[model samples]
Target chain A: MDKQEEQFVKAYAPATVANVCCGFDVLGFALDAPGDEVWARKKETPGILISAVTGVEGLSADPTLNVIGVVAQKMLTDLNLEHGLELQLHKGMPVGSGLGSSAASSAAAAFAVNALLGNPFTTQELVVYAMEGERLASGSAHADNVAPSLLGGFVLVRGYDPLDVIPLGVPLDLYASVLYPQIELKTSLSRSILKQEIPLKKGIKQWGNLAGLMAGLLMKDYGLIRRSLHDEIFEPERSVLIPLFKQVKDAALKAGALGCGISGSGPSIFALSPSAEVAHDIKNAMEKVYAGSGIETKSYVSKVPEQGVRLVEQSIYQTV
Target chain B: MDKQEEQFVKAYAPATVANVCCGFDVLGFALDAPGDEVWARKKETPGILISAVTGVEGLSADPTLNVIGVVAQKMLTDLNLEHGLELQLHKGMPVGSGLGSSAASSAAAAFAVNALLGNPFTTQELVVYAMEGERLASGSAHADNVAPSLLGGFVLVRGYDPLDVIPLGVPLDLYASVLYPQIELKTSLSRSILKQEIPLKKGIKQWGNLAGLMAGLLMKDYGLIRRSLHDEIFEPERSVLIPLFKQVKDAALKAGALGCGISGSGPSIFALSPSAEVAHDIKNAMEKVYAGSGIETKSYVSKVPEQGVRLVEQSIYQTV
Candidate 1:
């Protein structure tokens, strides 16, 4: 079938904080600040083509090797679209930063390619295609980052067997204060330090906290969220990789933050605050602690992004 | 202070299905049949007195050792009430059958004593006291059975340190089919076979299913509930202790039951269905499978009880 008209689509997928302390590989939410954008155009040819790539340093231009390229190719193949597509990958966040950099790129590509193909699949299908890209990078088909990055807001990866991702209702006033220290922490290296087996006692605590955290968000109980934002299973073992992790977390709590812990597998750490004002205060407190340790830090304070991946209009050309 | 009234208070606490497949130690729901009833009366004396114990075989009448007595004593000490209370413990369920028999008695005692003292504590506080009773029986402070028994519905044990029990909204049409195999399977013996360490992969699957189950109940998604009811962590090992466990579970599923697995530790097995008719049908299917294995089984089919523990009028004396 010959395509009558060609369409250009630009979409953005927000960065996400996966794991969310006690939730481990189950919970994540999109962030407002850093994200990836993909530009796609319909072509007469029958295969996905990589047109351009920019923003991130030291990345291969090969579509087969790139996150966005890999996700776009999978979507095209799965949908069996008659029209070929070309994609441009643009990264706004640094790679391997624990802030879901690859997920953002994959999500943006999936969202853009779907739009370019007239959105033949549901958002969940798009998430699955994006997860394939995540699998390419992580070697495991985990959806903690990809689901939230594609769906926006807080997403609970209920089960991966059939790929169930449920969006959770979050407190609108709640804010996150994230600090990305100027250091490289590859997810593989961070994951390597983790024990394959978690103590049953700690596992109980982690799941309890996970449930409590969900209840807290749904009921808008800040105190419960604060108390429940503890990770006995993963954080204690993984935080050893980050310098002054305990001090930074303590400073955030001392500074009136509800809770503080590692952001995914990290050199990045985050704290939860009830208000934007408190989130900024918590960011400053975290920065101060990191500054004391002579580690340069970049911080962000934003509410949970309600939209995951969205089409960008020409009017927004000034923004991204 | 002398009591102004010597009023009588009798309450019934429903039996519970704890563990709930993947949510071992953290989730449970009350069943409609086979529960414990406690009769309480205000006394001028300053301590708790156990007047009678019946129904369950081989249980000590000692207040300190018995679950009902232990829970009643804790409630009295916690409240510091001047008036003494006398309790008559009647167990309607079999002991060591893995049907939360002890939890029912403990919950009934807690609910009755609180009513006898004019409701000094909230229902959640009552759950904590009942959990203390469970600790006396299991040597662990687990709220899986006691919380749902006392609260009467699906309960999430979000945390046990300060004892946070959240009552969840359940599907009103959901029905449970439970079968007790008339065999003794002590909770301790069942628990002893479990590995202290679970592979992180299995742990991920377990928590995912737990979150999925909660989402299913909240969203009223039956398929999600069925898919999420799997248990990869505890059931594989514990099921070895129960004869014909696999055949019974498979038969229930074959009869169109949503999901089937061991209810708590075992000797009893349960299957969830979309309706009461299916539940009853599934029960018969399960019974046939057990009968083929030369095992006697008693089956009960009822909706998820919306009420946990409740007061009874004098007209119910014949039932007790």
Candidate 2:
């Protein structure tokens, strides 16, 4: 496709919290309407190439070293497709901030490149490609965030091969509030502070919450979600690193959030509420707690992202 | 009521395994048509007391120290039902040999006692009472095996407070093979070896499997269930004690079992198969491995206990 017909494939992928409280790396849902954007065009050249970056002042446009670049290249390499990508990342979400900002960029780029390459890979194969982005971030391959980002809604990664992804019918009433502090807690560091061997007792506690969370997502049972949101392993260890973790979480509960916890690896907190009314209230409470700590924060009161990364406009000369 | 007019309650409680590999103590399920038996009758003395033990050797009829006795007292105390009881516990299963020997006995006594007391608590509450019994043995409130034994079928313990229990709709094609290898991995000793904290990377993998298992149960999707039946956290650590763990698991997989793992703590292993045909194959393979290990093993091929603890003959009574 030439520049005249060169429509920009601008796709918006949500910022996901990979370890959603009880679920750790295997569970994640997309943020509704609040994600980052990646705009790509098929180049006449034959390899993936990052052309521009914005909002992330520290990032480089080098295609090989960038997280977004690596994901796009892996997808093309695996699919045996030969096409260069001119990717422009509009960093709407933060970097190394634990909202899965990098994954959003990666998902967007992989999704766009695949689209530009005529979309040969299946949705799950795209997820595998997106996981390369996660491997780059933390040196471990995880699908919790990437799977949901690629498939949309709530996805259970049953297995990698034959790729069993079960779609949970999300409750229509769910509203979420995610508060991001100005400080960044790199995924690498947040993960490092965690202990290597969890007590068997704590392991059971975490999975109990995991099973309940899965049920809650399927049944949209808010009460069960609140009861199941307890994370005995990561939160106890990682929360100590996040300022005012207790106060913010208590605020969320007091503000009527069904439950609240540090999102992913901290510096960001998330609350689950049954209504938009409660979601906003929970957001305000988190804001108040962060304010007391002399930290500015960005918060979102949204729903689970239903449509994952999608072309904002046909780029038939477009935007989303 | 005289002996001729006595109200006798008899109940069958299936064997259960707590922790269930990845789930630890928070997840468990009951095996059908094979377990233990409890027979209870109201005492004429107006106080709770145990009177007999028929099967498990070394078990006593004491009302305090006996596993079944303590659990029975707790159940009656909650009901404020002061009635001495004549309890006969028929231990069809082995003691201290995994397969939830202690849990089955406790659940049966509590369940029988509950029936004797007019059934005041819900099934979940009975599990709570049974968990109290486990505390006597392990010194903590754990529910891996007790929940499923009391509630029957597959159980996902979401939380302890208000105890979120989700009953999984198991696949109709599912058949379970419980192999007892004439050995015992004491819950206490097995538990003591676990690390105090787990690595962040591995924790997420466990949660992924947990969610996948739940989804598999709900969807009755066998392939998903097999793929999801993984224990990244506990099994890796605990399986070290169970000799031939990997080879046995591999053989079962090769024999067409959906998934196989260490049942309860150790010395026993269970495999899920699609049919009795596959189950027989699993039995042969498992027996071949453990039999060669210089360890004698027993196996039970069954299905999920469809109806949990229940009255077999409510109004009728027959004893030879």
DockQ of each: 0.58, 0.50
Q: In candidate 1, residue A34 scores what lDDT? A: 86
Per-residue lDDT for B132 in model 1? 79
Candidate 1, chain A: TM-score? 0.93
RMSD of each: 4.1, 4.0
Which DockQ-derived CAPRI band holds candidate 1? medium
lDDT per residue as tens, model 1, B1-320: 32344467889998889888887888899998888899987778777778898886678887788888888888878777787777888888888778788888888888888877768988778888888788898898788898888887788888767777888846547889999998777888999999999899999888888777776776677988888898999999999999989999999999888888899898899999988889989999988887766677888987897888888742212221
lDDT digits (tens) for residues A1-320 of candidate 1: 33333457788888889889888889998887788899988778777678788887887767888877788888878777776778888888877778888888888888888877768988778888898888888887678888888888889998766677888746557788999887878889889988999899888888777777876776667877888899988888888888888988988998888888787788888888888888898889888877767677778887887878888832212222
| Model 2 residue A232 lDDT score | 82
The CA lDDT at A8 in model 2 is 60
Candidate 2 matches the true fold with a TM-score of: 0.88
